[model samples]
Target: MKGTVLVTGASGFVGRFLCMRLISESWNVRGTLLESESPSCLADKVEPVTVEPLGRNTPWTHALTGVDTIIHLAARVHIMDDHAADPMTEFRTVNVDGTAQLA
Candidate 1:
């Protein structure tokens, strides 16, 4: 069997398709969801992993354990109406910091 693969933001469109394709290829698939209520497009096809938002001191060791590859798809693209004033800060935290945390 191939090594495990961790797909961040697995609920998203691209991630969802990637998970399915990876499963078809016989790779061990693990998915992480950002929103608890997000649709499970690849339900039962991949192991679902829990991961918190990437912030200061965010811990990701548990998420990556036993996983050989990480396909980072999580990102903060839009600032919510009630979100922080700086869009860049929000993006950096989720997009940049999330990648760093995974490393």
Candidate 2:
């Protein structure tokens, strides 16, 4: 909570609140969003980074720099018109694989 923290799904509701609160408490917050830059951030306290959720082979070296903690909030949300043949597999690809990519 006090050290450098990396947050995933930072464009979402929970991620937004968490980053704001952490900044208020004097925590160095680094958040990851799908877009190049999303939801803006505190110039001094929080750094917003752009990253894909299901990065099959993306390297997280630069993103994980100086990060002491990681809060994984990223997920593949189910939409009205489903497309993936296997929802669980798709979920694992993003949620599971993504987490590994970060770690």
Candidate 3:
């Protein structure tokens, strides 16, 4: 086995593909899901874990267990037409602060 890897946003586009590739490479894969249910897109070998509301306060201890590497793909994106009063803050909360907390 290549070792266990934790993939954040495993249900997302790129994440799905990456998880498949990692599985094929003989790595033990653990995938984070925003929802409680497992995603149909995820491969059978990928262990699914819930880590909703990706942000600074997201609880990650369960997801990080036994993980040799972390591939962080989760982020707030595609808000070009956002009408929020402070879109940057939302982005920073998830993209910057969330990532910082994860690291």
Candidate 4:
């Protein structure tokens, strides 16, 4: 094991695939999901961790502990509808703010 690799949004499509590939390579994997989501599906494949948004009072210190590398795949997807809420804000919140905190 090359230390623990932290993967945010490990329950998602791309995240799942990345995790599986890492597992096959014999790397120690740690996955982070929102507290509301279930990570049991990856139980045998990798270690699952529940993390909340940065401003939601979620403790990130524990999640980052011993993490040699971090692959952040979590983000708020863009809506096709023009009437949807501002995409810039959503992108900033997840892509910018979230990524900054993790880094």
Candidate 5:
């Protein structure tokens, strides 16, 4: 109950709100974001972790340590003009693979 809560995609809209709520409840929060993404405004409130692309070389192992709970909010967001790439692959990489790695 007194440990850190890891929140992935903490810079996103809903993720930011969730992190704020957790902070209000007095829980330590650690948030993760991609390298290209900007730092969250909540960075001052929670520890900000920049996660590399999901792969064998990525450093996701260390991020899960001491984490009491993991709230995965990172995923391949849908777009209107996004017919250039395979959505399923993107989703699997970010959502499925990412979650598996964390688990």
Candidate 6:
């Protein structure tokens, strides 16, 4: 085992590839997915954990157990035509506060 690594957004394009690479490198990969998302999309050997609405208050204790490293790929991606009343705050909530909480 290279080490235990927790990868957020493991079903996303970049995340899928990263998980594959880590798997090939012999790391124990734990992936975070949405409650409705399926773990079948991830690479073999990945341990999937369900988490939703990434934010400061998002519960992470269950996912953080024995994790040697965390590669945070979960974020509120920028939309070209974002319709949110406060887009910046939304982004900050997930990207900033959520990441901070995870750390």
Off by over 4 Å in 5: 41-44, 55-58
RMSD of each: 2.2, 3.0, 1.8, 2.7, 2.3, 1.5
44, model 6: CA deviation in Å?
A: 2.5
Which tens-of-lDDT digit does each residue in 1-103 have in candidate 3? 9899999888888998999999999999999887765567676789988886778898899999899999999889997789978999999999998999899
> What does the lDDT read for residue 65 in candidate 4?
86
TM of each candidate vs. truth: 0.83, 0.77, 0.88, 0.81, 0.82, 0.89
The Cα error of candidate 2 at residue 44, in Å, is: 9.7
**lDDT-better candidate, 2 vs 6:** 6
Where is model 5 poorest over a 10-residue stretch in terms of lDDT?
A: 53-62
User: What is candidate 1's lDDT per residue for 1-103, written digit by digit as tens?
Assistant: 5889999877777888888888888889989865454545555678887777776567778778899998988777654574678777877887777677676
Model 4, 1-103: lDDT tens per residue?
7667988878877888999989888889999877777778553578888788743234689888888999888877745674637768766777777777776
Cα error, residue 13 of model 4, in Å, equals 0.8
**TM-score leaderboard ranking:** 6, 3, 1, 5, 4, 2
Model 6 residue runs over 4 Å out of place are 80-83
Error of 6 at 7 (Å): 0.4
lDDT of 1 at 61: 80
Clashing pairs in 4: none
Whole-model lDDT for model 3 versus the true structure?
0.88
Q: State the displacement of the C-alpha of residue 62, model 3, in Å, after optimal TM-score superposition.
A: 0.5
The C-alpha lDDT values of all candidates are: 0.77, 0.74, 0.88, 0.78, 0.78, 0.91
Task: lDDT winner between 3 and 6, please give it.
Answer: 6
